[model samples]
Target: MRRRNLTLAALAAGGTLAMLPGAAAWSAEGSYPDKPLRLIVGFAPGGGADALTRIIAEGLSKQLGQQVIVENRPGADGVLAAQATSSAKPDGYTLLMGTNTAMVAAPTLRPTPPYDPFKAFTPISSAGQFSMFLVVPASLPAKSVNELLAMVAAKPGAYNSASSNSASELAMLQLLGERKVVNARYKGDMQAMTDLLGGQIHMMFTTGTLAPGFVKEGRIRALATLLPQRSALLPDVPTGGELGLGKLTITPWAGFFGPPGLPQAITDKLSQELQNTLKRPDVHAQLVQQGFEGYGMSPVKFAEFFRAQYEAFGATVRQHNVKFE
Candidate 1:
């Protein structure tokens, strides 16, 4: 869908990807990546994003003939990692496994934004997309989306919903509307899911990558998904549209990015290799098994897609009057 298109229409409208200063020197280099490269992840280890990044990093290492180290720097709903990557050298050695949370939501939600999503980094390529699952502890009385909302309604602000990212946070707000419920923030899905299983929280909007196992094991109950249709990973769970939440469509996605001024040659090489890596039968199979749809785009197209998603998210945040500290 729209995320897969990489916002082509946005690119078509106007604006070019801005390259930071001091990139020309590295752009001309013949041989690049003479050493190991660091791939920064914005979430803690064992989460969906971290798992996906590791999968891609393995394949990327094989493609580039160099080690693609996965580093975790989780904080501020992933702003810490994004900011770290943005300030790093533009030599392509340091890269970010960016998510909509850091790339779009953090900047859109915060009053004094930490960084500009587009200007802080160079778009490398689209990584993949997944849907969010509205999940609750298995022991909860609710079996469907309506039932869960009813429980929250019975005791306003009594039930708490966890959100690890801005997109998930927005999804929760869209569903609740004027309903009173506590919105608890966490650094990553794993942390939130832990509390969800312990009966500490009532509900959350989590990804297929992380929800399927818990749902299958009877640890959590998935009431609905944010996708327009049922997810293959959680076929039994109804979609937001199926539950009369058609407007609750939020596509959770991940992509690759380099620090500002990343050389064009290195960016192109990485993007092409990422595309090739995603197309690999083994890599593709793994990502799918984890509830992710693997895909990639050129740097130019990614730039356009980035702009589109950034603007779209910002507009959504404003329309909802969503705020974050």
Candidate 2:
């Protein structure tokens, strides 16, 4: 009886030992990025999203001690990248640099979007936020939001605002409808800016990264920003909210996301690395120079913030009756 008990005990002990390595392998959270990670940006190269992703990718590569490559898959107003990232394995190898337009506004704009915004992906962290500015050709006379409103009100449908068919355009349209201003629409902000410069379009609501350089060079005049407060880069410009157009507070934001069901260990590690990357002084300064505010948030906080933005954008879309083809 004693010999039989000893053999059974040995077998149980061996089984437990065999299970230990598998458990440790599953729970081994450190050195999170054991392989190359892909950071997907849903815009073409040389755009704001690409630029920011490149910066973050470099920093993340260093932090993870692995190659973090930025892959651009621009199409369908950022929907292609969203769908691809959403369907990818949730192993931390593939990550999406979530944007306001693709993740939040697209669902409301399209009758049937490719994926559900909230369920298709898990939030990592918000990298930054930036306010869109209402800018015109430097030669235009209107200087403030009120003045511009009056001008547009006086000549309804005479002025035009440009955007890239996402939240930017929808927000601007909602603001116009609220103020009862009629205007023309273009395919994208760049085209609108081209027309504005060529004396075809009158005005456009554009992102700071694209507007500041033109504003600085006297190519475009920044009339007002769509943020609650003035931008540090363009300190002289006032916010539309401050001018009693609080409804125009549309701040473009960017965040990190991965496929749903990512292990909490991998998610936590990625979030920590992202927060550290954003904390670098050079990164902060570069983002500020581009008229963006560094908006690093914890994963939980970012999820809440993203949800709020999604809901807000949806409301704006509904209010404006926006539809995309």
Candidate 3:
């Protein structure tokens, strides 16, 4: 299904497992999650995937009697985590926090992608959808996307941008394609963020899940959202279009996904619980604080969204001729 073979190393660091395969396993356990479940995320602790998964994991743990533990497997632009989820037992006990980075951009940017995202996993529910943000060091001379574009253009390779995931990579590809800047790579956004805070890298496009906290700390300032409309979280920040970079608009999303061949019973159960999780007041407030919102849709609806996103990202990939380095 992809140009490259997908191999996800099993980093089983103390988590519960679903019933082992066999027709009798279901009959042996009348209820789902007789044991705890593992929710896999593909980034380090401070990045978008890790942050969002932890929030959802807490809510799911309470809703289900067993704990839904989150495990980090950060690498290869989320291919590592997606591959782990794909190789997991499909009994619904193992799941992935499928983000645009992991599910869409990783595959789009690579030939022989680690896995065919749609084929390797079953869509559970849409977790969260959001616009991207152009984040720059507070010390950067530019305060808007237009100004940054000009700044980089004038200096050429004098400035460098950071990229950890495909969303940021996609943004950098477009920005660099036009203005030509250096891209300093990292295994995770948090790593890149480390440099951004220290002014080692000048700027990046980050998820709403990550940008606000740093911005509030004044370590970095979000110059603009990738969308044409203003963000609910950073109301004062203008959109790229508003800043005269209309070509920069891009909104990436994330969702819940389980290993392929997950039973309908388990899928429905988890989807319902995720919907409930999104509605919790505390969860909602925290998500809002980080610039994320609830996404409620049945597994069927989520599959539709998945297909649409798959098509959209494929177009972007082809248009830009993006590829793994």
Candidate 4:
């Protein structure tokens, strides 16, 4: 009888031990994000990417019952922020507001390739897309895309154009196509826009979210946009296609990503909340005004989409014969 009792107790203890991992996992998942979370952005504060990210962060904060702070780690066309996120603890506390520039363009453009998009991070959900606007200083003599090209043709390297990310750089390259224009690289759009406003640079590919207000205020001149249709927010601005500069078009997108090895439960929780946040009527309205289209997808769907985009960007780079300098 004593032996049987001891055997029963040992079995019970073993059972509890067997359940601990699962129970601990459940507890972790259930009480997740007890503290504030950090959402990294690769752009300076007050720029289009930063502004749009803040909006989503606010929505996420409300949904998760914690602060979702936007921490800017701007540099290397968003690669710095992405690298930080990829190397962070896989606790779901640190996330990246990744852009096409970081995920597709910057890496593809670089000679060494910082990190593999497939292995560096786990895709959470897509944030949205932006319209690229060809903007110049209001004081610039050129009034249209054609005039800008003519100016570049007439005076080889007299004008310097700024680019903060690969999408912008590629668009400018395609537009100029062997025309000698000095390339001024910036860590973020706001800094580049500042230079343009100060006459440090003559022109740049600014985003729709950042351009409309400045253009309306006559602070900058918008020559064209890379949108399929004229942005409703900037209805007066024509698209690159309309200007017969269709090759200048490029699609810029943003999304959320977690450090690799993030727990599945945490991933699902964040993804569902993000999708909800994007669907909010208030959120949708504000995003539209900022020249963004809110988008969301499940982890699996976004992963597939990310892979497809990576390949497409590679093809674009090869086709353009773009070389890293």
Compare the candidates by lDDT and give the number of the best one.
4
- What's the distance in Å from true for residue 273, model 4? 1.0
Query: Runs in model 1 with CA error above 4 Å?
Result: 1-35, 44-47, 75-77, 137-160, 186-201, 217-219, 227-230, 238-246, 263-265, 288-291
- How big is the positional error of residue 11 in model 1, measured in Å on the Cα after superposition? 39
lDDT of 3 by residue, 135-199 (tens): 99989988767688788889878988888756667666665566777787787677888888999
Off by over 4 Å in 2: 1-28, 180-182, 227-229, 289-291
| lDDT tens digits, residue span 1-66, model 2 | 999999999989876875774553355465466889998999999877788788888887887899
**lDDT of the candidates, in the order given:** 0.84, 0.79, 0.77, 0.86
TM-score of each: 0.73, 0.85, 0.71, 0.70
Clashing pairs in 2: none
For model 1, the local distance difference test gives 0.84
Q: Report the error of model 4 at residue 282, Å.
A: 4.1
Clash count for candidate 4 is: 0
After superposing all C-alphas onto the true structure, candidate 4 shows an RMSD in angstroms of 5.3
lDDT (Cα, tens digit) per residue for candidate 4, span 137-197:
9899899999999999999989899997777877788789878898888977889999999
Q: Residue 201 in candidate 4 has what lDDT?
A: 94
lDDT of 2: 0.79
Candidate 4 Cα errors over 4 Å, as ranges: 1-34, 44-47, 75-77, 135-162, 174-204, 214-224, 228-230, 238-249, 285-291
